[model samples]
Target: MPDYNGSVDYLKKAALRGSRLGLERISELMERLDNPQNRVKTIHVAGTNGKGSFGAMLTSILTEAGYTVGGFSSPALTGITDSFRINCREITKKDFAEVMTEIIPHCEAMEDKPTEFEVLTAAAYLLFFRKGCNISVVECGMGGDTDSTNVLCFPLLSVITNVQKDHTAFLGETIEEIARHKAGIIKCSRPVIYGGTDLTVSDLILREAKKKCSEFYSTDYFRVSDTSSDLSGTEFSFDGMGDFRMQLLGKYQVMNAATVLTAVEVLRGQRINIPDEAVRRGLEKARWHGRFEVVRREPYVIYDGAHNPDGIRSAAESIELYFRGSDIVLLIGVMADKEYGLYTDMLGSRIRKAFTVTPDNPRALASDKLAEVFRAADIDAEPFDDLAKGVCSAYEYAKANGLPLIALGSLYMYGDFMDALNNITE
Candidate 1:
């Protein structure tokens, strides 16, 4: 059996092939391994945003309902192992190594070697099947139609959470085109739930659901009667479902909860046996890190992976809602492919000062270029090639000036920012 480092290295080598979006390679690889994905029940979630939050909430609810739940997501927060989880815990290094040992030879023998994500998806399915997961929740890495996770033939449910203009190079440039890509997860005769408010996007999804002959549900079906949120947490009520509270902060999270609650109702209709108590407890306990996550309270530092335009707008709105009248320091880093101009423009006026850093990725936008964008938008901006220095400067400025510092942009930078914060605090 391979050691953990060796297995991780193997996966990294596969990643060198890069993101080839299609199901052919994954399907062939899974077939070579006897297709373990077919043995498990799955809920497929696809969207530009909120996929992780929705998946986590659903997994928590399933686990709370006393089922062995498996969860698969992508671009893990801290480590690759975080992508494969059971009962909210990442697969142990030993288990990850064992699974890699079992699959690497098959991967090597394949005529067209699978990409890293495809291999990981196969590994997750095999692990969940072998470990006896009662149900599995899979979040699509990108567009639903061609994502590796689309290999699942029939999922228990498909959720499309708020389609936005992202991954335009692959998905599409227009919202309607993007909506079509997200809508591809809807299966024949299955059920689908959508959480987006855009009428055009929702109508497109509705039409796709109709074409698939699937039962459709939307966030419009649920009414959020009362809602309150701060950096600490969010509390809200779903008309008849009762009041729920969660550690995840933001108005968007409240909408995500409404989507999950609507999904719970659909699950109940399908006789899943999820009790109201389970839903309440699951929402209360479910935590998705790196989205408005507070790492320190004294200087009031927040880290959010709001890389896209819509996400940046939401983060800006949350800042206004929670820290209005306070000086806000912005620490930003992002991938080169994103609309950095739009992102900076959306939150520029609110930012008292900006510190830009390059995220740790090949596609990272240069810190100097990001600083230029912020400066062009009339926000005071500075650039740093080193994340540690950037974070330190931001923290010192925020503390000295009595301002709240927010770190936003690419998820790739989160680990670096977290490490820097820990070092400074220590």
Candidate 2:
């Protein structure tokens, strides 16, 4: 049997085979594995952004209601295993290795090998079913139509957190094109909820749901009022859903929370017995890291996974809202393919000095090239080859200058952030 490291290396090599976005390989794997996805109820989440946050919130609410729920998200914050978790507990390395052991032989026998993401998605389905999860919240890897996670035949509900320009290379260049792919997750006769107000995107999703005879609900009507917000957290009220508080910083989070309440109401309509107390408790406890997360205090170190335009805008807004008058420096690492115009346009004003590091990923943009982008913004920029060294240098500079430091960009770098922070504290 393969150990954890061996299993991870095998998947890494499998990733080199590249991502083939379609359901054929996944469908075959599911059929061979006895279709465990259908055995467990799932809530399909797809969108350019906020899918992770929404899934985390729903998982917390369901767990608070005493149901065993599994959650699956991408670019695993805790490495590969964290991508598959139950009730917020990451799958153990031992369990992951054992599952890979069972899944590998089947992969080897396949005529057309499954993509790395497809294999992982199939494994998550089997893991959720075998672990006796009453429910699971699954986020699509990319566009919904061909994403590996779209294999769910029927979901309890389908959620599109928002529609935006992302993954344009494959999802298409326009908002409508990207939205069509995202709307494909709307299963027949199932309830579908959308958290975005882009009229074109909403209309497409609504039409798709209507075509499939699915009930459609949009959270656009929900009124959200921010009661209070500080570095600690935010307090808000979503119409009749009652007041709630969450440690997740940013006004955007308030929007995500409202969408979550709308989902709870939809679940209630479906006869799922979730109590109000559970909703309140769940909101208070729900946390999805790497989105405007403050990792250290005193000198103030923050981390945000704002790899794209929308995310960059949100992080910039939150920084302005929280630290407008304070001195702030930035530490950035982004993908080679991401859109960068918004990065400088949105965050340029807040940056005092910038440190660039190449994230630990195959597609990461070179640190020096990223620094060149920063320098174009007319901000002082420096590049470091070693991520940990760059992080320490950024923190030290921030400390000496009496400025807060925010590390932003690719989610793939979060694991590296923890490692770098450990080196600093130790």
Candidate 3:
């Protein structure tokens, strides 16, 4: 009875239905618009984490090679427009509103309504083709097989960054099940590049690629040598790709960069003309905001979005390596489905204290419960009922003790945490 408008408010309403992973709704929605996904060339990226950073790296290098690259990643980090990018620039609010306006009616009219991610995927497809992109790198929202983005007709290639235990309720209960879900993107006999370290996952992906009669490339043999990592980000040489540096921190990021290079090699094999210089320049310029991003100095603070145990382990490795003996405090929040035990076990010994707050999401773990997780690991923990107070208190404690504070977990928390952190007095 009510009509949706061009305003972002309508998109917010669509998102409230939450995540229901499937391809059927998106398939029908694409049919309504004559299927824009089939008109464009795309590279599909899927993983539990680091996939966004990998996409960003690939986008930068491709842009350096003189292509108009469209990007679609999830969670919208700071704003609704953060999910969509063309040639490394975000789609303007005006353009985003206009595009969604055209697509909203079809979504509203669908008998089986599409989820927000499905609508976003369709919008990205339409935007990529309509905007005249040479090629676009699209990241999956969650598990690969049933993810709405899998509706792609035929992509240049499929990249599976890594498979870890995450979104278990939706994906499945085991790593094998999860790997099967991620391997779903291999289609149309397109080549696949597997970047995961897990042998089982890689073998599973290899089987899927074989089933599709597709070529498969793995990052397993790539040697990273003469490496150095600190607060300035990682610098290393990868198996003849030459020396490279990425502004994004952590050693895992170095591996992620190497994976991008592996993909670039595959692209070059397909007659794409990405030069060695583009790879070097792009890695130096690639910036994926909020993953181990340092937002302030003096009493230092970082904003990281390490939500799962595996991701947290990677982040923890980088943090420990960079600030081995320094005084550190943690400001954390997490989702309801996450197993927080490993988070505490790995990070507890390094933190002076932890201040916990609930993220502003429907599935966020309560602040008190998160604090309980930390305390069970012998971490000194404080719980806050209000996000701002928690941030201010954490800031004050870190400042008083001359410690660096890390605000970690849930991508949902970064927007709110940064807003609160900005208001604190230095």
Candidate 4:
């Protein structure tokens, strides 16, 4: 039997084969596995941002409603195994290794080898089927149409959360093009709930739903009112569902919760039987780590994986809303292909000092290059190749100057930041 570390290493090697986005390899692979994805009811989620959080919330709601739920999300926050969850708990290492061992032989036999994501997606489906999940929430790996998880033929419902400009290289260069890709998840006659406020993008999605004969619902269906947030959590009331609170912070979360609520309404219409009390408790209990997550208090350190322009803007807005009138000491690390300059421009005025570090990935932007971008924006900036050194510098500076520290940029840097915080606090 393959050990946990060995199994993970094998998956990592498959990842080196790179992202081959298409349904053919995944379709063939799932066919060999007898298409377990079809055996279970699924709520397929797709968008540039908010897919993970939305899926997490939906999973929480279903779990609280007394249903066994399986969740699959991409670009694991902690480890590869974090991407697959049963009842909101990550898959155990032993189980992950055992499942990989079972899947590896079939993967090796494929005429065209599946990508790491494809393998993982297949594993999640099989696990969900074997475990008898009442339902599953599957977040798309990338653009919806051709994403590995799109192999689901008839999802119980399709969710498209707020389209934005990211992954332009593969999805498209424009918002309309990206929306088309996102809308690809809409299956014929299935209900789709979209949370995006962009008129152009929303219209495209509506059109796609019409073309596919899918029922379409929008955020307009539910209004989020009396929204409030602090370091603890966010509080908001949705139409008919009053006074809901969530551990997930930011106004963006209110919008995401609205999407989840809208989805619940549709599910109820389909005879899912989710209770109102379950919805309230689920929102309050759902936790999505590394998004405006506060790690420390004295020096006030926050870590947010806001790598894109729109995401960074939302992070900046949340910062201003939460810590208004306080200057932020920013620690940033990002990928080479991200819109780092735009990120700086969006939050530059609010930042008092900046420390840049390279994220732990081959595609990470060089620390010095990131520093140069910040410097050109006229913010005091320094670069460090070593993430530990960068964290130390940012921490000490924030402590000495009495300013809050915020770490932003790539999700890949989250582990490094957490390690740094652990070292400092210990």
lDDT of 2: 0.89
Worst lDDT run of 10 residues, candidate 2, spans: 220-229
Clashing pairs in 2: none
Quote the lDDT for 224 in model 4.
Answer: 75
Model 2, which residues run further than 4 Å from truth?
Answer: none
Off by over 4 Å in 1: none
TM-score of each: 0.98, 0.98, 0.97, 0.98
Candidate 4 vs. true structure, TM-score = 0.98
Candidate lDDT (C-alpha), each: 0.89, 0.89, 0.88, 0.89
lDDT, candidate 2, 1-426, per-residue tens: 658898888798789879788899999988889899999989999999899899988899999999999999997986799899899778899888988888888887899988899989988998899899999999999999999999999999999999888888899999999999999999999999999988888889999999999999999544787578889989888777778899988758888888889999999998888999999999899888898888888788889998989998988888988897875889999998898755887888778899999998888999999898888889899999799999999999998898899999999999998789778852
Cα deviation at 69, candidate 1, in Å, is 0.5
Model 3 lDDT vs. the true structure?
0.88
Candidates in order: C-alpha RMSD to true structure: 1.1, 1.3, 1.9, 1.2
Candidate 4 — which residues are off by over 4 angstroms?
none
Model 4 C-alpha lDDT per residue in residues 130-241, reported as the tens digit of each score: 8899999999989999999999999999999989988888988999998999899999999998888898888898899999998999876347788889988888878786
**After best superposition, candidate 2 residue 171: deviation in angstroms?**
0.8
The total of clashing pairs for model 2 equals: 0
lDDT of 3 by residue, 1-426 (tens): 223244467777778878898888999999998999988889999999888899999999999999999999988888878899998888887777767877888998988888778888998999898899999999999999999999997899899999999999999999999999999999967999888889888889998889889999998544888789888778898877678888888758888887898999899988889988988888888988878888988788888899998888988887888888775899998898998867887787789999999888889899999898888888899998688999999999998999999988898878888889888765
**lDDT of each residue in 1-426, candidate 1, tens digit only:** 568999989988998999999999999988988988888889899999999989989999999999999999877888888888999888889988988899999999998899999999999999999999989999999999999898888888999999998999998899999888888889999999999999998889999999999999998634896788887788888997898899998668888888999888988887899988999999988978888888899889998889999999999988988898776999999998998889766787778999999988999999999999888888899999999999999999999998999999988778888989999952
